[model samples]
Target chain A: MIARRIIVLLLLLGALAEAWPAAQTLVLVVRRDSPVTDLDSVTVRKLFLGVPVLINGTPLRPIRNRSEPHLDEIFLQQIVAMSQPSYDRQILNGVNRQGWLAPSEAASVTRVAAELNANPNAVSFMWERDVAHNPNLRVLRVLWSD
Target chain B: MVRLTHSLWVRMMSVVLIILAALAPLLYLGVSRIVEDGYQERFINSVRAYSRLVADQLEALDAAEFERRAGAVLDGVVLSGQVVFAQIVDGERKIHSSITPALGAASPREDYTFGQSPDQVYYISHQVRRPDHAVVLRLGFDEIPTSERIRATQRHVLLAIGGFVAVSIGLALWLSAVIARPMVLLQESAKRVASGDVHVQLQSHSSIREVAELNLHLERMRQELVGTNEQLTREIAEREASEHKRLTLERRLLHRERIVALGTLAGGVAHEINNIITPILLYAQMALDELPASSDLRADLQRVVESAHRARNLVWRILTFSRQSDTQAPSTVFALRAPVEDALALLRAIVPTNIEVVFRCEAEGVQLTGDPNFVQQVVFNLCTNAHQAMRRDGGRITVTLAAEEDPGEPQLRPGRYGVLEVSDTGEGIDPAALPHIFEPFFTTREVGEGTGLGLSVVHGIVESMGGLITVRSASKLGTTFRVYLPVAVALSNAAGAA
Candidate 1:
């Protein structure tokens, strides 16, 4: 009886292991504004939170990604350095002012940038690969290595 | 209702055996394949290492000399216990061998023969090279060691498989015993239940939970079956009693209907006879008035007068229908209060003195279309039945009459239905018996005390006159009998219009 139970348990565990999903990575992309090549954790967080800041003293707003799996706290700690709660609090504090917008994906960042350039007040984030220049939009400088 | 195609034991045994059978081939092939693969892996690794060694060694020699020296080196290695023989061949199929005697005997001589030989031996090959070109070198081994290792592995695998199969068989036997025994018991219990022994009980004690659960189900089924049997028996007995009462009630109702028909027939005959007698009496009286006192016609006149008297005697038969409380004839329209009072008066005489009878005749100007005497009989019967129900002591009977209207059904009309409710503060009638009460001769009273015809007569008269009667009673609440009759024909007709 015990043996039979063990066999059944093994089969059930096997089935469970087979159902688990593969692990994935979350990446951050930035464009150059100064020779300052890669991003620091603090500046990435501040820009994503739409804290009005200067890059060579030009006021800028950063964009965010809206895709799932939504960037969790772990992703923030390792990459963006700001928790989702802190991000939401910052957004709520500046709701009426021009704030950062999360494009649907990295590809839409160019469109958002073009739209933002036309409006002067609007700004958004997109994937680095999707940010080839249309005449209207330019990459703002941020901090990062490779 | 869901039937199993396979019993637990059979299914378990088949699965165990099939698993064992499958494992036998799998274990044999797997162990042998693993052993062979291990040996082959070692052989290939050794061949690679040995080829590198031979190539390094042969680098200083000319190509032809290299083949010859390589063959000698290979022969030296083969002279060791594990190796059989070795050969060196140029790219052409001509072999230079240290074992020239063995090669002379081998058919289809070639420069390099590798893999398993036709004699069922395992061999390994490598390319020996000079700077310009390469030569192939082969080493042959007897393969006895690999075979022996494989046989040993086979033996271990067989032992392991044998051990597992033995354990599985023992387990299967034990599991089948655990599962099959309880199932067999349950099957037996089911058979017994089918054969009309629902009282049998199943005791479940098994390591196998499913079997234990089955035994519990069997036990529950038995309990349910026993309960259903008891309920069925009770229902059957009640039905039989009801049937008996219904038959008696039917007999009484038929008798009452017959009596009423007889009364109507008598009334018709009496009317015809009375009509015939009226003219005869008129003629006789006229003749008596006109006849002279001195004439012999006086004696004849006296005879005529006597005949008229006899005819008058015959008219009394019509008075039978005029009985105050007879259970025959259709009732006529009358003031409802009088008949209700008259009925209570008669019941007062018959009921025990301890029982109090109260009458509230609040309904006035109320009339009904049935015979007053028959209505009185109905009221009297209902009161007496209620009184008898309260035979223990100090019971109160409340009789109430009121003028009310039908709720709807314009054809039945709305106005002036006289409600006569007789309520008794007594032990209530059983609800089981309530529907049967109106059926003739259906009575809770013992035989001879009641013919059970009272409610049937009540129902018949009430229905015949286009009225309604209802009763309500329960174990907790006392009994109430309500009779509703139309007060006047005109009022009913007018209400129909309204």
Candidate 2:
């Protein structure tokens, strides 16, 4: 009984430790052929928060990563710097008032990569480690780093 | 019918029902509250989660062509079974689901909890972020599922309660039987005993000690009562026999005294009658000597003398019946058959030929210690009375002479006796006249037909000897006279009458 309880306790602590945010250098990515190379943190935040932005006469659209574990939470915490509800609320406000479209969400790494390559203005946030093996995608800028 | 209101079974059932009445409401209320709250919380939480999801979709909509696309988002919310109404509220702008019902009747009221609204709808709102603006997304979830679930749970609870109540009543019935069975049996048994049927022994079918003990006591009491009743019955019978004996003795004594008084009076009357009739007889004989042979007056004179002679003989018989014998004549043991046959022969000659005199003597040598003349007279008188009784419709006069070894009467000494049974198939003596039959001059015949002294003389003759006389007669049936006399045993003054 003691051994089983100790194992369960260790597992729970591991999960809690994993759940705590750690310093990560999150960068915005786009297709290598895209015109956009870097964006300032302020514009990146507004774009991710459902603000309508255009770069070099092309409409900028943000794509959110859904399938990556805890990627949305980390992005919201570091880049958006807002709670999930607050972030969603800001985006919905812009859509309702200006009739603007909100950011699109992709469910997998390949899906995010596909969106980035297809749309030149499409940008998405992910850990830099995930972008390393995808040669077709390039980091536009460091979205956040500890 | 047993009165259920006062019965043990009813009492037991009442207690069980009272307990159920007390607990059923508490159980129903407690269970209903738990089910309602659980379903309510679950419903509110689920509706809130679905509303948040709809808000998420609103926030995720693309800005370009947002108007056309947002309509699809709202319609999707309406398509989901949980939400019946969906809308987005922005400053100075409102967007409702295209498929939502027209709400011109009433605006949706937001619900804080699942069951807080009467519309069976739980309304909630979530804010969605938009570019420089946040919009409120309101969703109304249908609460029917939660309400139906609660109702189903409550039905199950009610079924459980009902089952419990049924089982309790069954148990109460069984318990009441266990308690009331012995008492009911005892009560029925007690009723039978009260109705005087105590032959059945009181018994206990109860396992309870007190009931068994009570039965034992009651059984003892019943036995005691039976014994006491038996003793009282025996005492009553014996006392009745004693009273009858005393009355019989009194009657016999009174009859004897009357006979004695009548004998004294007859003796005196006979002496006077003899003196008067003797002179008349001598004068008539003297006149007859003087009368001429051709004279008709001679015959009439002769009748006067004849009647005078009859009066003389009657006075003589009266002397004998009155026991005016100079000294008590020596009573001799004699052949009973000879005298009985002689009396019957004389009776046959004198009575109507239709009254056949039949004599039977079974005891050939049975001798009685009384005077033979007394037996002869007794036979003559009883036979004469029988002859008179049957004069209207003549019948057989049977003279049965048998030697009785056992006395027929209880007052008689145990000895050999000659029972002379003289039975006549003739008109019987009246029952009202039966008691006075042996008394002097008491007869059913008309005065000119009989002197009514036949049975009186017979009773006197038997009593003077050591004997008893009993007569049995029924109206229109027949008359029988049984005369029992001691055989060859001198018993003086043995007078008994029946």
Candidate 3:
């Protein structure tokens, strides 16, 4: 009976693990030396979608990450409000019109954070927990919470 | 009306005006259509660009942020003077707008289209897509201003057309003058020719070939007419000269016939007078012989015998003058001065003292073959006629006897002859009576004053002796009678053969 109870508890724990999502927080981050202190949701969305957003006459440069599919999906759903393929086509159109394009895809979260830390005007999104201990990066806004 | 139709200027102007009238309206309509089409295209492009700008701005915002700034965004579009009543609506609800209307009021069609409101303002509407909703943008424009611009352009085009037509008419008139100038000159020259002035010369220096050719032909005709007129004038002068010569000959023939008729009548009358006179002369001479000499009765008888002898001599003279004597007396050669002197002496006693008689014997030794009494009678009768002619304005009488050769008298043969001329300064014979002066009983004197037979008898005596007579007279000038007698040598030779 004690073994059967332990098996049930383990099974219930697996179901609970499957039922609850992982703790995922999308944060808008920039270099610590950036003039921007904070951004609204609309401004952050505008920046990712290749739309130019200026803070005190300074343009924000956005960076994208390719290593985390889950974070990318949440950002696309909350900020871009379009499918991945649709957003890619929009970016292509923006490139043809001589607008700004996302830089090279970041290889990892550390690389994304490092790119934000290197450029004062650069902006990107990452998990809040991953950036929590870093002092070299700034949290510009919260893009999504799950 | 007739003159107006004929004017070249008028006709050319009319044709130009008609063409302008026909083309003016068509040009206006085509220009107006092009202007309207171009303006409409430009207006549509501008409105579409405005709608696109509004859509891009709205699309970049969240629903909540769009609500906060929609009014400001739309107000900026409306202030651009291209839009009116811009609105952002989602489904049946209005989020923001330039102006508010009742909810659920149907928005205009969102596909770019034009409409007119009740106030007569023109508006265009377009639908723009936002992230969560569709926005309706209505743009109002004042059509009156654009229409006014179009009308002003139309008026300028019309004025330009009118100015062109006026210039064309003026050019047409100038062309007409250039073309018709030669014709006007030709008409004037032709009028002069018709009025008998053929000397008019037309100008041949014309630009038109036909007009120059016509002028050349007219010049040739004028030369021909001048030649014909000169020929006709010469012919007329020659005809008049011949006509005058013919009339002179006709008068001479009529005069000769009258003299011959009177001679025949005088011969018969003289024969009767001679027979009666012979018986009275014989009886008176026998009575005178019986009476003695040295007694009173004897002297009276002697006077009667002498008177009877004188009467018998007068009868014989009349018979000879009338050409009725049975025995013809032979013509004798005598000094022509003797008869002329004798005639002047007798005429001086009978003429009025107001008349002066002068006798001239130019040929003192000139001789003639004719009866001396007959020569004396011709001189006496011519002088007597001269004295009678001058009785009204008593003037001079002249008797001249001379010898001439080839006197050119038609009846006198071409030889030396004695000429007796009698002249008087008097009221001369009338030209109407000159031809009839030798006719028997054709006298200008009053009745019973003198016999018209005096000149006829003188003509017969002169002609029977182989001589001729002619007379000339003029009014207020004088009278002259010439009697031509044959020379003694020529008459004797003529008589010897006869």
The parts of candidate 3 lying over 4 Å away from their true place are: A1-146, B1-137, B163-388, B394-435, B438-441, B447-498
Using DockQ as the measure, what is the rank order of every candidate, best first? 2, 3, 1
Worst 10 residues of 1 chain A by lDDT: A137-146
Model 3 per-residue lDDT tens digits across residues B1-498: 989877766676677678878887787788777776555445544554455456556666677777678778877766776455566655566654545333223544222222334433444333434555455444444445556666787778778867776787787777767666776787788788778887788764677788788878887887788678777877787777667656655666666665665556665665676576566666656766665665567676667667766655544444555566565557787888987788778888899999999888787777887678788888888888888888877999988888787887655667788888989998889999887777666798889886576776687787778887888998998999988888888554564476
C-alpha TM-score for every candidate: 0.33, 0.51, 0.42
- List candidate 2 segments past 4 Å from native: A1-146, B1-4, B23-157, B174-248, B271-312, B327-329, B360-365, B403-416, B443-449, B489-498
Candidate 3 residue lDDT tens string, A26-66: 67788788888977555666787788888789788888876
Assign candidate 2 its CAPRI class: incorrect
Poorly placed runs, candidate 1 (over 4 Å): A1-146, B1-16, B26-34, B37-253, B264-335, B338-357, B361-398, B402-484, B493-498
Worst window of 10 by summed lDDT in candidate 1 chain B: B105-114
DockQ for every prediction shown:
0.01, 0.02, 0.01
User: What i-RMS does every model get?
Assistant: 25.7, 12.2, 13.6
Which docking band does candidate 3 fall into?
incorrect
The lDDT leader among the candidates is: 2
Q: What lDDT does each candidate get?
A: 0.62, 0.78, 0.70
| lDDT tens digits by residue: candidate 2, A31-128 | 88888866755577678878877888888889998876567655754456455655677788889987878989999988898898889889898778
- Per-residue C-alpha lDDT of model 1 across residues B12-116, encoded as one tens digit per residue: 888889988988888878877777676655553444335435444654567667645666776666666555656655655645445434532242222111244
Q: What is candidate 1's lDDT per residue for A71-110, written digit by digit as tens?
A: 3322333233333444455566665465444322233444
Which prediction has more favorable TM-score, 2 or 3? 2
